[model samples]
Target: MYVCPEGHMAYKKARSLQKNSIKNEKLIFFFDVEKCKCCPLEGICHKIGTKSKTYTLTIKSNLHQEQLDFENSDAFREKSRMRYRIEQKNSELKNRYGLKKSMSNGLFGMTIQSASTVFIANMRKIIREIEKKGA
Candidate 1:
């Protein structure tokens, strides 16, 4: 079972459970993003256009009403800190690698360009790691 960031239900068993006779994986959905656009609690429980838009969810384990505690939880805050890193990496790839704007015109050319960009990025990361180690 994989916990989606949107707190949506997901139930894909691991390879070890392939031979098992289990029918349903029973994935639970939990989250506090009920004020966001996709949330059903928006406009009813909370006011519109709030500055502190807190979007969070948990699906691996069931927390019931305890999910509210995550609002002020240290672990949650730390996890949210990773949002910037992810956004930064996405922007870097999109800008430097031209991920969204492919130079290739056809399918084959696009595939080659994508592969080459990934390879180049990986190589750069490896070189940076080696340089760091030497330093």
Candidate 2:
């Protein structure tokens, strides 16, 4: 979609590697210099002494905006209220349970360790709640 100020259409020149980005490449485009070397719009598009016109198209991250309606909504507030308690529980699991590092190898071992840790934590919570109600 790149066009020079003189209404000349740009064509694909090369696929240039972006130094910082791993997944994206730059599509370099060039305008026909024969039609633009002496173009009156030279200063507007490029420097007046430049030989040819070239540009790269990059989609800015701002173009992919998040849903603003979901940010300050009721559901958002509800989750925000639970975030602290959930994070505290995760910290407890990591410190008290051997969740900071896997005690064994492979997916099966990790699953067993996680299941046991969560089961014990939930059981303790249920016992505490029952004792509180009984008191």
The C-alpha local distance difference test score for the whole of candidate 1 amounts to 0.61
Judge candidate 2 at residue 75 and give its lDDT.
96
Off by over 4 Å in 1: 1-87
- Clashing residue pairs in candidate 2 are none
In order, candidate lDDTs are: 0.61, 0.78
Candidate 1 worst ten-residue window by lDDT: 9-18
Q: lDDT at 133 for candidate 1?
A: 100
Q: Distance (Å) between predicted and true CA of 123, model 1?
A: 0.6
Model 2: per-residue lDDT, tens digit, 1-135?
577756778865777676776444567788776777667876777776667678987533432324456665899899989999999999999998768999999999999999999999899999999999999
Cα displacement (angstroms), candidate 1, residue 111, comes to: 1.5
